[model samples]
Target: MATFQKGILGGFSGKVGNVVGARWRGKNVMRSLPQRGSYTATAKQEEQRLKFKTVIGFLSPLVDILNRYFGSPQGDKSRANLATSYHLKNAVVNLPTGTVMDYAKVLISKGDLRGIDGGTVAAAAAQTLNFGWQDNSGQGKATATDELMVVVYAPELNLFYTNVAVATRDATTASVTLPNFMASLEVEVWASFSKPETNFAAISTYMGAVTVL
Candidate 1:
């Protein structure tokens, strides 16, 4: 491994022969490319790999939401990466068949902003979800104009239906109507709030499972 003072060929950015070069942090660097070969993973390594795949597959679709509310990035880790690390450690479970995600433990958004109070969700007419929450507008950093964010996932369908900035905190209620294709499907529901005036968000609440109308 080597760091170039003047940068090789003005900071090389690709592979040439056995060496690969790119900028890391703010400095140009070069290193030998990894040799291509087959290697066996240890039991622990394989388990970690499975957990990564499981979490990535589930969270990839929710990247926008995760990026917004998961948490601020630390050094090289982005918010999405932070979210993945968190679920990998806390939400994934190993089973006799394979590593699986526990839906109840899934977090669509995470932050220190004031969270929903007495939140609930239930099936309503026309494939809609009726969401209700007690108004907590004057509580800890909470404001009347903070908007709602909702996420619903249908695991059997492998799809997510989400709404961002849907309703104000004072509204105390909101509804989400899924596509007709989602009718009668059992879905997991979650809710959070974000202040429109700034990049602030509340940790989300999982409102339990409900069958869509």
Candidate 2:
């Protein structure tokens, strides 16, 4: 009976060992199955985050460069002072009564005054003046007879209206003769009408070459 009992005990132990081994192998196989979908999602999210960061980094530098070129903060005032000329063919004309006058085309030219040489003026001093003088009852007809004043400013030399001229009337056209400003210098122009018109128009003038010392 003792021998029988010993054999039975050995058999039961063997069966238990086999069952445990099989369950362990099955658990490992399940664990090994691909988690590819989860991995792909994670990778995509990381890529998008990196791309967004890169774009933001590039834009930050670009904005800084633009600000520098455009003279932001303290630089703007200094840069404005250095500008050669602030061309003003499209300048708004204000009347004494606080009403805005309509602008017509105006032109400007640079060179020495007629018969004068060696000195130059801004080039192409020509523009048109537009105005309507008549009220609803035809009381006033638009007139181009009023003299137009051309004033020029040069910041480099601290000059104001160093060169001035008047526009000549030609029917509906008006033109001013400009003298060669100091060579190689930037200059600003301003215009005023002797009388105001009811309407305004666009005008342009060419700047003259600056002489370099």
Candidate 3:
């Protein structure tokens, strides 16, 4: 019977009569306290939470990088939030009976119909990294320009190198120059097709992580 307008900083705790206040999605809300006791989630629920964390850890660092090029289809938030939400939900849920979701692959594709295939990475000159991939745009979809995202982390040094490159749809390779190279580097590569008109990018293909010599 009561609807409040926006523009209020929300913080609510304890209980006021029959109504309890809480903050949700950056907004203040009131609801009746539940009668149930606290309980732990099941094994399957925990597994899904772990999946969400894994997906989030990988994508959080890439938010700035994604926003620079892909922006967002929704506009209100960065594309990274969209990618995270999509994959977190994707980790759970049953498919159409016969279908099975590949969480590993889903982490990279992130729900985009077009994904990279046969991607390979190698150390290119002194501080440059080379990446190559095959287009996985099944049928009917016209081949569009592709964008490449490369993230390199040196565990020993606790360093990260992030870079993005653009390639023609027909081109299968691109390279990025790092600020400096370590003896051994762990790298994760992703690629997505660009919809220039909409300023949106398709789901990215995770090119797998590799240690380069």
Candidate 4:
């Protein structure tokens, strides 16, 4: 198969010995076809590939924030790439489950002082929910300031409410006001903490699965 541009002069195709003609990405191109052989990867290889993909997709959008907070790897030019690769390799993807990441664990491994402890949730109002956690200022970790990401999933409506930056971890409790459009159903809340100066975001854990009163 040959890929051609929108207004290419002519079409090109047919296999010329090892090379095959094909059109790709708005241009005419040719490349060598695969040799006759089994193209399947081993089980372990597939598993690793999937893991890499999951990490990449999750962290790609936060490259700048990660680099800024985590700081650059010593003597390395590509700070964003460095953080991404390091976390992807050292991340424990099996803590909460084999496939899903236990969010706080990843952050702690990277450089967080510690994961939020004793996280508690309660309904503050008809549309507001409050979250509180033990202040880790006593830990004396590298970070002095904290931030949070709150994710709420409503199973009854199959909806998700995500607030990437709820607030700085200055206070012990943070409140989240949900949209009125969401169904009044039992919702599961997950939380992750990050330092203000570093990219270390703790692994997110389930806060609770409760119905708002």
Q: All candidates: CA RMSD in angstroms? A: 2.2, 28.8, 7.3, 8.0
Global lDDT of each model?
0.89, 0.30, 0.57, 0.64
Off by over 4 Å in 4: 1-111, 140-144, 156-158
Better of 2 and 3 by lDDT: 3
Give a tens-digit lDDT track for model 4, residues 89-171.
76537333455443433431234446678888887557688898877765655243667777776655655677767876657
| Winner by TM-score | 1
Clashes of 3: 0
Q: Give each model's clash number.
A: 0, 40, 0, 18
Better of 1 and 4 by lDDT: 1
Residue 134 lDDT (model 4): 72
Q: Once superposed on the true structure, which residue ranges of model 3 sit more than 4 Å away at CA?
A: 1-15, 21-29, 34-38, 65-82, 89-120, 133-148, 151-160, 166-172, 179-182, 195-198
Estimated TM-score per prediction? 0.89, 0.25, 0.57, 0.52
- Candidate 3 per-residue lDDT, tens place, 126-185, comes to 666677777654433526455555556554454567655456555788776666556456
**Which parts of model 2 are misplaced by more than 4 Å?**
1-141, 162-165, 169-181, 195-213
Worst 10 residues of 3 by lDDT: 98-107
RMSD of candidate 1 to true structure, Å: 2.2
Higher TM-score: candidate 3 or 4? Answer: 3
